[model samples]
Target: MCAKQDDAGAPHHHGPGTERDTDGSDRFEVDQEVQHALDRLTLLINAAEALSSTLEVDQGLRRLCRTLVPGLADWCAVDLLDDHGRLRRIVVEHRDADVTAPGLDEGLLPPTEGSAASVARALLGVGPVLLTDFPPPKDEDDPLCLREKQLFERLEADTAVVAPLRARRQVLGVLTLARTRREVRLTEDTLSLVEDLAHRVALAVDNARLHAEAQHTAERLQRSLLPELPTDGPLEVAARYQPASTTARVGGDWYDAFVLPDGAMALIIGDIAGHDLRAAVMMSQTRNMLRGIACDRKEPPGKILARLDAAHHILYPHQTLTCIYALVERLSADEPWLLHYAVAGHPAPLLVTHDGETRFLTGGRSLMLGVEPEVHRPAATDMLPPNSTVLLYTDGLVERREEDLDRGLARLRQHAAALAREPLTTFCDEILEGMAGGGSDDVALITVRTAPPHAGPAVATP
Candidate 1:
């Protein structure tokens, strides 16, 4: 009976050992699965980081090809369709090898005359398309596909996958990958991954193209708005328009000088509110109105602005404008009086004396146009001596966020004083250069100097 009991206990001892072995095997399997998932997640994160860092489309394609091939496929090539719907090979990569030069030029495979590529072109309409089990045409043999098959034969590949890249439903390019049948068969999972990558590439390319187009348009508009400098003049004028640092925010800042009917020169500087197409449109309107008023009215600065204010409400009831308008009349042999200037919520004009002194012409202050119309009061007048220079500009010159307007004014004053003794043209250039260094807001400067009696006629200079 003791021997029987011992035998039963021996089997019970083995039961716990068996349970321990099972638990260890299960834990080992769970750990291996967890590690595989972690590795895949890490690889995806790294690839996404690489894709996001690039702005150049070609460099981005190369990076993408390097990231996908070997890990996802043995070979990969990106084919982009031109504007004419012709497929053009762009980027290509092979496992542990550089791209073959002739392969890129010869590897372009179109819609195979009437196969899946043609069907995709018709159905997708330039958007992303995925082709599975795509075969060459039944009738005439395709030279391109034959070449591709030969290439794949060398790589021992039996399956091919292609995905079109698209943005806003417009096809930008196509991505193709080939894999050996022994390593992996092309499946839905592989197709979905390629689609996602193509989408990202398309978005990046579209953004860059839009940015370039906008810049070109802005530059062309700026050139058209600014008139060429007068042919001959003693008064040299130079103007520069610097766009805002932030992309998509080009504003309206302009300067103008032309002879009035009365033989006096009219100098105008203004800034429109905000930075958009609306601001640019309003700028054009305001400038034309002021020019018309100055030429037709031939009145004092005060009366001209009153007319402008009335026109502003009639034309643009909801918009506003800030301006400094001055009329320079040659009074005597060597003296000029800047008659009847007003500031409608704009920066005061800067006056530089012949003795190298600078002062702000802070005269009458009134509400900006389009706000309310009242009897426009005449601003205070200051006489410009011979060789003296008067500078009129927009408030973007003296308005910084961290610093107060006073500080900006002080900085302008300091620079103006240093340039007071220089030629009016030089002074204007120096002021613009200094302001550009600080920060670029829209800037416009107009400089007019009183001519001496012996200096003869004052011609326009730009």
Candidate 2:
């Protein structure tokens, strides 16, 4: 016997003629085992990397199919349940050198009534599945059997192994791998490896799905909470809400505009402290309370916010909020071009003149709402030129990870200056779009452009 070193550096004995003998059968067997282990490890590592690389569902699925095909199977396909709970074939991978797999051709695939997908239904339970044995088509005349045969021919698949990609009892999708020839049966170890890969794929799919669903929900809620722009007025309002690329961070960033009972147009924008259900609820309360104060007391912009700050301190002592509340009123009948407003604990509203000049109304700074309410003061007395556009937004518009708030404000001023010639609606949307790229926070921009006296009714732009 001859001794050989294991992976842990421990000495292990090999049979006779195995020591330092390249031609020995024992050496060959050991080499084959070590090579198989390495291959399995490589496959596992690649699979994990592929799954962790992206949060996009379609992209992840496509990568998963590509990872498995031509390496572990002759063909791979993933069928996912759509919004209607019907299984839709989303990705198909084939190991053909001469031909590409079919695209999303709905006609080429049969419905999920009685198909291999039915086998995947078993995954709705616990543990992984290994369906090694499958019955042959009962009859050539059967439509289901014919469809299955056609599908196999198209992908050049023979024996198939179906695994359910499940996460926390939710069936995300089904992963199917098939061989090109019936004689190429899958070994137990190979099936086990594939099952493990399927579990990882399931987790990735679940994460992506959850993210998309959350974004969709957040967008809907944000839109609903946002006030609709006024139809008839000298004030032109445009608002846009862009969520951060990170789906989990979606929250209560909102803009509001309406004509107060005193005839002054109220423009308000605010951001809650956190990005969760708590923030959304707080935002709703704050907006409603502000509206009530504006209507009942007909208070000045500064006083309304001060009162709101006091109330919030009493209600939510631990939470914080930043807001810009401006009450716009025409200076006089003849001076339709001049508009006056106020601000509090928020980004200074930008004043963009018709001549492409941009100005920030940074009169002063005050404490954010709900923090030392009595000590905080609201800034007042800012005016805009006629036909001038005033942009009100949350701090998210000008706050970046590595950059200071001043730099963000300067960037906004530059963009607004460039877009000053554009329509108020278009300019507002463009500014938000430009500033919202590359890991920026959620942005809420409200542009109120004082329309010329002769201009038509005001319209709201997204």
Candidate 3:
């Protein structure tokens, strides 16, 4: 009757101090101990991988929680301090989907000082705390305390480990774990493992915060430097820009449409070669230089770019870029509107007709800016068909990783043609909605919509 005489089909447990302890039969117990050690080692390895999986904080933490639940512990909860010095409950996870306590959604928590002593101590960077049986919160009036009480009642709380996530002499957050069964109390060994995990989590959180802050500052600076487009013009102009998604990868995509000293409207879109802050700085320098040269030189698109290339060669050497500089104008009322443009190692301009036909403006091509200053950058001209739109864009709009360059070009063309008949803003919006979804590269594009077929030699407004 002792332990029901365990058979091979059921798990066997040898009684302590029975014949197994002193005789040669103790080999089985030794084997069990070795196997348990191996399992713990495996869990630690997996936890490290999960924590370092991504630079995104919430995503990486969720991965870590999944690696722990139902295996390391029955429940895992992480609370992180924000830049505003507020404690935010980032995630709460349980092995079973049905096991949830009332008012247990993730959000900002009440000040840790008002909560249970264990949570308060952990947040203060006091060493790890082992939580066992405790009296129901003395004052359940506190939201944080009340929530913990509810969880204890609902999950039949047994044991828990609370550790401060500390890195660089500061506590960034706290990690909490709990198990329901009382027979297997979380021991000191478990406490050591939890502290190691908290250390890893702290470093990851710090890196993610730094990246986010940098990205925000860079984007704000970029927007501030961007020039406003002309709202009232015969050629209805609209532009769009989007930054790359990689962490801390910012800058280099820009678009501008404005009037030069003369009567012609200047259209410009370009991308500096790299995707870092240096790339962004060069982009601003290169863009401002081009605008100045265009205003003072009074030349065609080709010659204007020649000046840009020369100026940058002296001012910011060793930097390269792809660009399109075009002027859309008609000398007189009886003349047809014309587009004169030049491409400097840039993607060909796309032309979408009023009837859903698409074509690339492939003439006027030359090397990128940094390569050669003296080469004659060629120029091309095409008459604007009534209501047709010319789309100028950076490579990001028509290029992607591991895909043929032609394929991205074809995708852009297809999306542009389908939206050809829509309004100017909608056409640009839909094109972006269709082509720029989740692209990792930065993008800048300008849509120049001409007046309808003309009464004179030029296409005229109806």
Instruction: State which candidate has the highest lDDT.
Output: 3
The positional error of residue 34 in candidate 2, measured at the CA in angstroms, is 5.7
List TM-score per model, in order.
0.63, 0.79, 0.85
Task: Name model 3 segments beyond 4 Å from true.
Answer: 1-40, 100-104, 111-113, 333-335, 452-462
**Clashes found in each candidate (C-alpha, N, C closer than 3 A):** 5, 1, 4
Looking at model 1, residue 26 earns an lDDT score of 100
Q: lDDT tens digits, residues 184-281, model 2?
A: 65655666887788788888888888878877887777667777777766677788877767655567788888887666888888888777767777
Model 1, C-alpha of 2: deviation from truth (Å)? 25
Using TM-score as the measure, the top candidate is 3
Task: List where candidate 1 sits over 4 angstroms from the true fold.
Answer: 1-202, 229-234, 247-249, 337-339, 421-426, 438-440, 456-462
Predicted structure 2: clash tally: 1
Report the Cα lDDT for residue 145, model 3: 75
Could you tell me the TM-score of candidate 3? 0.85
User: What lDDT is obtained when candidate 2 is compared to the true structure?
Assistant: 0.73
Query: Residues 4-63, candidate 3, lDDT per residue (tens digit)?
Result: 445666755567566546665578788888998898788888988887788789888888
lDDT of 1: 0.69
Winner on lDDT (2 vs 3): 3
